[model samples]
Target: MRKVIGIGETVLDIIFKDNQPVGAVPGGSVFNAMISLGRCGVASTMLTDTGRDRIGDQVVSFLSDNGVCADYVQRFAHGQSPVSLAFLDEANNAQYMFYRDCKVDRQDINIPDLHADDIVLIGSYYALDPAVRQQVVALLDQARAAGAIIYYDINFRPSHRTDVMKVTPNLLDNLDYADIVRGSVDDFEVLYRKQDPETIYKAEISFYCKRFICTRGAQPAVVLADGGVVGEYPVDTTDTVSTIGAGDNFNAGFIYGLLRQGITRDHLDRGLTQQQWDGLIADALAFAAESCKSIYNYISVDFGNNKQLPNHI
Candidate 1:
């Protein structure tokens, strides 16, 4: 079976709601997705770094418990592992405050030899950080050379806007390396000061990536594929706990669709018909919705139970 290789940060999330501590879980954009995929019986490996502290040990144990391979996770001795305090609002959406110490140097990542149809998922600050951009690009180049499918998630946080200009080149370079590019309305707005997904696609992002997925909260997610005509999938909303890692799990489901249908680099851009696209995105939406229903950072059991879609092409 082809594997999923994820490169990103790993942190412990301590959530608080209504002045009460609610739940805690290990999370990172790519890390969360990798866990979901691992649980689905996908061969998943995470390349990241954590401290040698208690939180770091928990992160390693958590990944192993979820069936994620942690052989590539570098353990540092100097600092404590990163942590995020997520405070939930009335809408159950999380606002995060982060604490970090040791900034990992990417020279330590052990990049495994990849196979032709393997999928590499990378995103967030981990993909765009100046210190690590060269290493990230190099890995993507290797993955592309090996004919692996590269999926990039532009999970740009608002706090990083101050450095947007400084990081634009690296960000675009990462997009160029991607076979499928996924982002959110907020991501584009923070990076380009643009709220319109269509406008961002037409003006800035479409040329760099042929398959573009733009997700808007509580609204229809947009897809711009071969020939640049637009398509959409509306979200199925429900009563929620918190919106943490929703997009991450969406990537998991999307990649799951691609894998289940046996999509590979040779046909990754072969333009699925409307029905096919709907089938794949249905899984994506379901996984994302399931993540929102809990305080945990990944998919719930209910989502895993209903994985099949009968009408897919």
Candidate 2:
């Protein structure tokens, strides 16, 4: 069976609405996606670290409950589990304030066995953190050598603007390792000061990676591959309770689509037909839309349990 392997950080998110705390959930860039994929009955594994604390225990339990393998999660005696205070604005978008107890020894986890056609998901500051970048690069290299399809998500945030110059090389390296790159318009705007998908793709992305997915919140997501825009697919505009994990679930949905369509490392290099891309994007959009209906950091278990794969695939 094809598996999805995600490498990133894990955090507990305490969400607030109108200055009042509403809900708390386990979350992380890749963790959110892995949880959704696990619930979707996809074989998923997470490579990350957490403190040997109550929060870490909850995180581990959450992953297991969601059906994600927790064997690769590193638990350290030093430091404390990270947490983020997410304040939801009137638009239902999140503004985050993170609290972390990071130690020098970060990302102390073993790389699981990767096989051909496995999808490797990685990104965010975790991939660029100097303390862990070498390990991340080595893992990426091994996965690529093993014929895995690597998906990179440039989940850059405004808070990292100051480090953009310092991390440019690392970002480029990740782009070079990726078979497909996914990012929101806001991520590109923060990284390159450009919001136009075409300009960003041609000037910043094309030289490194051939496939780029640019998502605009609540707007049609643009797909660029082999040099230019292949097509734009409309997003489902549901009543968004919170946009915290919308993009993460979209990534999971896209990976699910790839598995459903029988896309593998071979198909990634050969590229997909227009029809295939459309079906995949539609699947992704549906997941994102469904996630927006709740404040949870991932797709609800019920949604994933009952979710149907795109018929065209």
Candidate 3:
């Protein structure tokens, strides 16, 4: 079976409602997606590091519990495991504050050997951080050499806004190497000072990567692809208990859609028909909608066990 591999950070999210911390869960951008894929019966593996503390133990154990392979996780004792404070507002959107204690010297993780049709996930500050850039780039190189698909989620959080200029080169390198790029409007706004999907794709993304997906909070998502094809799809606006990890699960569902459709590198390069894109978008929305119904960072186990492809899709 083809596998999905993710390289990113691992943090314990402390979700706060009003002024009190109510729950804690393990999450990272790609980590959250991997967990969902694992639950959905996909082969999921992750490359990340955390301190050898109780928090890190919980993270590793959580991955195993969720069916994600944790063999490549590096546990060091240089510092404490990362923690994130996510404060919820009136609308259940989170305001985040992160605490990470990692040294520049301790991020040595082995790049996975790749195979054709495998999917590699990479993005966020972890992929751009110079400390891990060489390893991340090496993995990307291997993925390309092995004919694997590279999915880049530009999950640029507000915390890294100040470093946008400094990391532009890294960001562009990632975009150039990606087969598909997904980002929220907020991410592009922070990276390029642009919001319109068409404008952002034409000005910033199309040159480096043509398949660009732009999402806005609770709004329709816009997809721009090769050959001047443009698609704007309605999103699920069902009542959300918490908006955390909604995007991650969307990525998972999209990947699952790709797998279920047997859309490989050849199909992507040739271009997907509008109906194919609709199926993918529907799958993405379904996963995201299911995730929003709870506080968990991934789809509920029951939901995962019973997930069905959108009827029309």
Candidate 4:
């Protein structure tokens, strides 16, 4: 079976509502997706770094409990693990305040051996950070050479808006490496100052990648493919408890759908049929919907264990 390899940051998220702490979970843009995939019984690995402190211990333990391989995780002895305070608004959306300790050496880990058709999920500021750019690019190069499907999520946050110009080159570099580019309206608004899906796709994304997925919170997700194929899938309605990892879980669901349907890097160049695209998008929406009903950062363990892809695909 092809595995999912996620390269990103890992931080412990302290979720708060109404000025009180509600829950805490290990989360990162790609880490949440990997954990969800692992819970769904997919073979997954996380490539990240953490300190040797208690928070790091919790992070490593969480990954192991979720079935994500921790072999590639670099444990640094000199720094403290990062933490993020996630304050949920009335709309269930999150605003974050991060606490981190810097180390001169970061993301110092051996890139695991990748095989053809393996899915590589990478994004967030971790991929754009100047400190780790060379290593990230090297891994992407190797994955591309191995015929792995590379998915890039532009999880840009408003906090980094000031450095958008400095990060734009790295962002474009990641786009060049991606087979599928997934970004939200907020991410584009911060990166390109554009929110319209078609405009963003045609003017910015299409030049670097041929396949694009634009997600709008509580709205429909728009998918654009080669040859002018465009598809839209509406988000499922749910009584959302917290929207922390909704997008990450959606990514997990789409990747899970791809694996279930046996879609691979070899088939990507040919593009997916309308049915295939719809099925994938629907699965993504389902996962996202399921996650929003809880305060946890990923799909509940029970849901992931019992979730099944549609039989038609």
Model 1 misplaced regions, further than 4 Å: 102-107, 305-313
Per-residue lDDT for 133 in model 4? 87
Stretches off by above 4 angstroms in model 3 are 102-104, 308-313
TM-score of every model?
Answer: 0.94, 0.96, 0.96, 0.97
Better of 1 and 3 by lDDT: 3
**On a 0 to 100 scale, what is the lDDT of residue 38 in model 4?**
88
What does candidate 2's lDDT look like per residue over 83-182, in tens digits? 9999999999999999987553675468888889899999888888887887798789889899999999899989889999999889999999999999
Query: Ten consecutive residues with minimal summed lDDT in candidate 1?
Result: 304-313
TM-score of 2: 0.96
TM-score of 1: 0.94
State model 3's lDDT.
Answer: 0.87
Off by over 4 Å in 4: 227-229, 308-313
Worst 10 residues of 4 by lDDT: 304-313
Candidate 3 per-residue lDDT, tens place, 185-241, comes to 899878888888888888888999879888787899888899375688888569988
Angstrom error at residue 80, model 4: 0.4
Candidate 3: residue 116 lDDT (0-100): 84
Clash number for each model: 0, 0, 0, 0
Give all candidates' CA lDDT scores.
0.85, 0.89, 0.87, 0.89
Worst 10 residues of 3 by lDDT: 304-313
